[model samples]
Target: MTHLPPSEFTLAVRHETATLTVMIGGELDYGTSGDLLNEVSQQLTAGQPPPADVRLDFRELTYIDSSGLTALLMIHRRTSALGATLHLDNRPARLERMLHLTDVLDHLTAPPTRAGGWQPEEDDGLTEAGMT
Candidate 1:
C-alpha cells in the first residue's frame, strides 16, 4: 500500500481594519479540515468586532478533499450570517477545479444579498487567474 506523509497544515492570520485574512498552507483534507474551521471560529469570537470580510488565502495550499470543501461552505455560512463576505484567494489550480466541479466555488465566494442571503453574482469581477 502506498503511504502518504503525515498531513501537514498551518494557518497564519492577518487581521486588518475590516478583513481577516487567513493564509493556509499544506493539505486541507479530512485529517486537517477541522483546523481551518476551528481557527475561524476562534478568531470570529475572540471579543473583537466581526470582520466585514473573511478571506482564505490558498496561495500555499497543496491539497484538499471533500471535507475541506465542506469546511469552506461552513465558513461561508458563518460569515454570511454576520453580514460578511467570503473571499477565496490565490486558489491553486487543483483546488479551483475541485471547487468548480463541486459547484461551490461561487457559493463559497459570494457576497451577501439585500435579504441577508448568499447568492453568486453574475459578474463578480473576479477570475481564478486574477485571484493571485
Candidate 2:
C-alpha cells in the first residue's frame, strides 16, 4: 500500500472591529479539520466579548472533505449561540458544490434567529390559497 503525504493546512487570523476573519489555505480533511475547529473555538471564547461576526475566508482553500464540512457546521452553531453571524467568504466552486449538495448553504449563512425561538414571517394579508 502506498502511503499518502499528510495534507498541509494553514490558518491566518485577522481582527477588524467586531469582525474576525480566518483565512484558510490548503486541504481541510479529517486530519486537519480539528485544527481549524480548535482555532476558531479559541478565538470565539478568548475575550471579554465575542466577535459580532466570524468570517471564514476560503479564497485560499484548495480542498475539503466531509470533516471540513462538519467543522463549518460546528462553527456556525458556535457563532449563532454567541449571537454572532457566520460568513463563508470566497468559497471556491468545489466548496460551493459540496455545500449545495449537502443542502447546508442556507443554514450556514442565515442570520441567527432572534431569541425566544422562531419568528413568523410577515403576512401581507395574503394566503397560499390566494384569498387575502
Candidate 3:
C-alpha cells in the first residue's frame, strides 16, 4: 500500500498473474483525481509487458462527483488503448445509481449489487435515487 501526497486517496497495488489490482479509497473528486491518474500511469509505464488487467476496487470510496466519473472514464479509455481491461468492483450504492442514471453502467465491467447482496440482472434499467 502506497500513499500519494496532495490527495486524500490511497492506492494499494497488487500484481497477480499479469493483472494489476488497485484498491482505491477516499473521494475521487477533481481535487484528487489527478493523483490517481498519475499513479495508474506510473504503474503502466513501469510494467514489463504492460498490464493485462487493471482492476479498480471502489469498495471504500465515499464519494465521487462528475469529475471523478470523468476520471474513471478516462482511465478506462487509456487502459483500453493499451490493450488492457479495466474492472470496477464493489461500487457504493449512490455511485452505482449515479452511473446507471448517467447511462454509463453498461460500459462498466463490474457486476451491480445492492446493499444487501442483491445482484440485479443486467438490463434492469436505471433506478431513481432522488438525484437530478
Candidate 4:
C-alpha cells in the first residue's frame, strides 16, 4: 500500500473590526479539523462585539473529508447564533460539487461577493474572491 503524508492542516486567522477571515491550508480530515474548531471557538469567545462576517478561504485546502464538513457546519451554527454570516471563498470545482451533492452548500456559503480595484491592506478584514 502506498503511504500518504501525515495529515496536517493550518489555519491562518486575521481578525478585523467587522470580519474574521480564516485561511485553511493542507488536508482537513478527522485528525486536523479540531484545530480549526478550537481556533474558531477561541476567536468567537474573545471578540467582544463579535464579528459581523466570518470568511473561510479554502484556496489552499488540498482535501477535506466528512469530519471537515462537520467542523465547517459547526462554524456556521456559531456564526448564525451570533447573528453573523459565513462565507466560503475560493472553493475548488470538485469540492464545490461535493458540497452541492451533500446539500450543505447553502449552510456554508454566503451570497456572491463583488471584486473591486482595491486590495486588502494588512488589517482590512476578510477579503473575498469570486466563487466562479
User: Each candidate: what lDDT?
Assistant: 0.77, 0.79, 0.68, 0.72
Residue 67, candidate 2: alpha-carbon lDDT: 83
- Tell me the alpha-carbon RMSD of every candidate: 9.2, 11.7, 12.3, 10.9
What lDDT tens digits, residue by residue, belong to model 4 across residues 29-69? 77777778668767876756777788999898988887778
TM-score of 2: 0.80
Worst 10 residues of 1 by lDDT: 123-132
Cα lDDT tens digits, model 3, 1-132, are 986664366778888888888888988777777667667767766756777788999888887888777767766655665667778889898789889889876675533222221122222132211112
Give the runs in model 4 whose Cα sits over 4 Å from its true position: 1-7, 110-132
- Candidate 4 matches the true fold with a TM-score of 0.76
Model 2 ranges off by over 4 Å: 1-7, 114-132
Off by over 4 Å in 1: 1-7, 114-132
lDDT (C-alpha) at residue 28 in model 1: 89
- Model 2 lDDT per residue over 1-132, tens place: 998765568999998889989999989877777788778878877764788899999998889998889888877877787778899999999899999999999999988764222112324242212210
Candidates, ranked, TM-score = 2, 1, 4, 3
TM-score of 1: 0.80
Give each model a TM-score.
Answer: 0.80, 0.80, 0.73, 0.76
Q: Native-vs-model 4 lDDT?
A: 0.72
